[model samples]
Target: DASWISNGNVNGLGWSLKDQMGSEYFGLRACNRSLSALHAEMEGLLWATSCMRDMRITSVRFETDCSDLVDMTTNPMEWPTFATEIEMYQRLQEDFEDVSLSHILRSRNGRADALAKKARNRGYIFSHIDQTRSYGGVLRRIGSYIST
Candidate 1:
């Protein structure tokens, strides 16, 4: 999910990855230059893809509430405005064995939506990785420190 604060020209991007059981394994919230909500959604997906690649995740199915994003990603030629970003996504997909993007109802994406809104409101960046389950690693926070 992504959010924009017009006053500060801040764009907040957020994404959450969950297993079949619906437990979150990874999530991120970041602030960036102001962009349209659609562009911000694409940025969030790019960030999520890069993070999953770093974790050596071989297969992924990304879900977003933006139908236009899904169409743009699935058929890049159809969305000229996002041609560069679509090309970037293709490059990132090479690292994975399989990848797919789907659209979901906005109501079903509350967590990611909240994270994006929080980042927009706070005007900062942060990431939360739940590595404790299988990676035998502690939760890591890397970014500006600010009170909630």
Candidate 2:
């Protein structure tokens, strides 16, 4: 999910990885300059995908509450505004053996929505990754915060 400050040029992007049992194993929050909410969502997905690849996570399913993002990825030619982002997303998918994006109800995505809002309200400019499950002894990595 993504959040935009009303009077500023900053946008917050957040994403979380959950297991089949609905347990959140990983999550991220970051701030960036996005042209629109759709763009912010795309940025969040890109960051999350890169992180998954870094961790050697090959098969995954990404869920978002943004239906437009799903549509944009499914039919890239119809969304010219997000052509570049869609292209980048396709390139990232190549790293994984199987990957898919699906839309879920907003009510089912509270955690990610709240994280995005918190990052936007706090003006956080760095990426923070929280790994609940230990991945080869790598627990968590707190990025250096940059003040605006």
Q: How well is each residue in 1-148 modelled by candidate 1, as lDDT tens digits?
A: 8886556656766677766543455555666664577888888888889888987989999889999989998788889988989999999999999999999999998878887787777665555544323233444333332322
Which structure among the candidates has the greatest lDDT? 2
Error of 1 at 93 (Å): 0.9
Q: How many backbone overlaps does candidate 1 show?
A: 0
Stretches of model 1 off by over 4 angstroms after superposition: 20-23, 125-148
- At residue 51, candidate 1 shows an lDDT of 80
Find the 10 residues in a row with the least total lDDT in model 2.
139-148
Report the C-alpha displacement of residue 143, candidate 2, in angstroms: 12
Q: After superposition, how far is residue 131 of candidate 2 from its true place, in Å?
A: 1.5
Off by over 4 Å in 2: 20-23, 133-148
How many residue pairs clash per model? 0, 0
Give the alpha carbon lDDT tens digit for every residue of 1-148 in model 2: 8886556556776777766543455544656568777778888888888878987889999999999989999999999988888899999999999999999999998888887877777665766666454456554443322334
**Model 2 TM-score (2 dp):** 0.82
For model 2, which pairs clash?
Answer: none
